[model samples]
Target: MSMRKPLAIFISALMASSAANAAEVYNKDSNKLDFYGKVVGLNYISNNKAEHGDKSYARFGFKGVTKISDQLSGYGQWEYNVKTNNPEAMDMGNATRLAFVGLKFADFGSFDYGRNNGVLYDVSSFTDVNPEFGGDSFTKEDNFMTGRAKGLATFRTSNFFGSIDGLSLALQYQGKNPNPHKSEDRRDGNGEGWGASTSYDLGYGIQLAGAYASSNRTDIQASDKNGQTADAWNLGMKYDNAQLYLAAMYAETRNMSHYGISNNRYAKKTQNIEIAAHYLFVDGPAEGLQPSLAYVQSVGKKLDPVSKSGDAADAAASFKGGKQDLVKYIEVGTSYFFNKNMYTYVDYKINLLKKDTYTSATGVNTDNILGLGLVYQF
Candidate 1:
C-alpha cells in the first residue's frame, strides 16, 4: 500500500488555474502564478504462460501555483518515475514520487504535508481509473489502500455537506517517521495510519463513495494472531456522462500485508468485488473510439499460523487453514484519440487463481496481461 499515487495532483490543477481566467506565470496586478505538468508512459507485454515479457516506465510531473489572497493559495509538486526496466542503478530511494507542499482554502478545505494519497483509496477511485493496472492488484496485497504513505497528512473538502453541491471530503494521516536509513523495527506502513473519504454527486451522472482505513502493525508484536491491526473499507459507484463510464466497487481488507504472504509476516483476509464499463462512441465512426470492460473478484480465507512451517512451500499456500482463495479478473481495453495532445491505448488482462490444494509461489499473481500506451495531457 505504499505505491504512492494521487497527490491530488498539484492541488487539483491549482484550483483550475486559480479559480478561472488564469494562465499567469506572473500576472503582477492582483497577484498570480501558475504552472502545470504531465508526462506519462506505459509499455507492456507479458505472457507468463511459461514466459514472455516486456517492460517500460516513464513518468514526470510538475506544478506550481501561488495566489495569496481572495482566500489564499499556495502549491507545489514534483514527480518522478524513470526506471525503464531498471537501468542498473536507478533506485533513487523511490524516485521521488511527489515532493509535496500545499495549502489552499477558498472558503476552507485543503492541506497536504509530505507524501499523500490514502484516503482509503478514494473509494476505489472509479476502478482505479483503469488506465493500466486496476487499483494495483490484490490478495494479500500491500497496496495499503492504493499506496503512497510517508509522513503523510491530508485533508480536503468541498461542499462538505452544505450547499448540497456535490459533497466531497477526504482525510488522511501517516506517521511513524524514523527511517534513519531503515531498520528501526522497520515497519513503515505499520506504525501509524488513518484514512477517510466521502463523495456524493447523486445527480445525473451519479456518484457516491465511501472509504475508511486504519493501520498499526508496529511490526506485529501484539501477541500476534495476525498483526495487531490493519483495516480497510470501501464502497463505490460512478457513472459519467459524456460518452459513458461506469464503475462499481466493494472492497475490504484486514490484516493484509502482502508481496509474498505466508512467505511470512503473516497478514491476511480479503474480499474485493468490482464491476466496470466504458464507452465512447461520440457520434460518427466510433468517434474518439473507446471500449472497456471489467469484472474483478477476489476472495480469501485460510490464515492461522503465527508459528508452524512444517512443510514450507508456503506450506499449503493460499493461506491454508480451511482453505479458500478465489480470484477472477477480466479487463479489456481500447482507446484512441489522435488529437488533444495525444492518446493511444490497448490492454487485455486476465487473472484467474481459483485453485486450491496447496500450490505455492506464494499465490502467483495470476497473469495474462498485455498493454500499450501513449497519453499526453498538457
Candidate 2:
C-alpha cells in the first residue's frame, strides 16, 4: 500500500473526530503531526445593541500522535481562539479552547484527561450544526458537565470492543471546580460529577444518541433554595448522507439553568428542543452550495417568584412562579464553498419571542439577527 492511502485514511479519521480542517505535516517512525486553523471575518446586525457588532475570530490547533507499539499509542491536542474584533491595546478575548492528552489501547478504548467537552454534548451536538447560532439549548461552556469545561477524565470506546459494528460508549468524571473569583456566579462552581453517553449507528446514515449527567452543587449554589444536585439528560437522532443532513434533540435540566445578572437566580427546571436540516447541492450548477434551516427553543420552569420592592435592583425583577421562555428562534442560512479551503455564509435568525410583561421585565431580546461571514481554513 502506498503511504498516500494511509495518510488519507488518517486524515479522514481525524475529520470524523473533529470539525477543524487539518493537514498532515509529519509522518515518520510511526509518529505523526497535523496542523489546522481557520480565520473567520464575521458580522451580525440586530436591533439589540449588545448583539450587533463584528464577531471576527481566528482559531488554530495542532494534533500529534506517537505509536509506542502495535497495541499502544499516545496522542495529544491543543487549540486556541483569538477574537480579532477587539482593538490591539484591549483584551482580544484569547482563550484555550481544548487541551488534552490520551493513551489509546488498540481494540480496547482510549482514556484522556484535561479540559474537554462533556459527555452530554455527545447527544446535544446532533442539533448544534447551525452556521451562526443554534446551540443555545442548555449546553453552555464552563457550566459543570454540560458543554466544555475543566478537570475531566474521560474514557471512550467504539464498536463495543469490536463486537458491535456501530455502537459507541463514553464515560466521564469531573472533579470539583472552585470559583476563581469571589464575584463570579456560584453556578460556575461545581462539585464532583459523572456522566455517560451512548450512540448507535443504524446503517444507511442514521444514528441515535443519548446522554445523562449529575453533579453536586457548591454550597453557595445550593443555598439559594435550589437543590443540592444538578442533573441533565438528552436524547437525539440524526440522519446524514453525502448530500443531506437532518437532526433533532430534546433535553431537560433540573436545578441547572441560571438566569439574570445582578439579581441572578437559578431556574428549578428547564426544557429544551432543537431541530436542524441542511442540503448540499453537488455535481450541478449549484455545486458547492448548501442551504440550512433550524429551530431552537428553551423554556425555564418553576422559577422563584420575585417581589417588586423599592430596591433599584429589583425594579425589573418579576416572575409569577411560572415557565419563562429563554430562547426561541428560527434560523435560515446558506453557505457557498468557493473551494475546499474557503467559504462564505449568510444566516438570518428570526426571533420568535413575543414581547410581554415577562419579557420586558426579564430583558429578553426580541430582535431578529442577521449574520454574514467568510472563512478560510487549512
Candidate closest to the true structure, highest lDDT: 2
Over the stretch 88-144, how does candidate 2's per-residue lDDT look in tens digits? 998757989889999999978999999899999999888887678787778887788
lDDT of 1 by residue, 269-299 (tens): 7777888776665445656666778887766
Q: Which regions of candidate 2 deviate over 4 angstroms?
A: 1-20, 261-263, 306-317
* TM-score attained by model 2: 0.92
What's the TM-score of each model vs. the native? 0.30, 0.92
Pairs in steric clash, model 2: none
Highest TM-score among the candidates is held by which one? 2
Error of 2 at 97 (Å): 0.9
lDDT against the true structure, per candidate, is: 0.60, 0.83
* Model 1 stretches with alpha carbons more than 4 Å out: 1-122, 128-133, 136-158, 170-195, 198-212, 215-227, 231-241, 244-255, 258-279, 287-289, 293-347, 350-360, 369-378
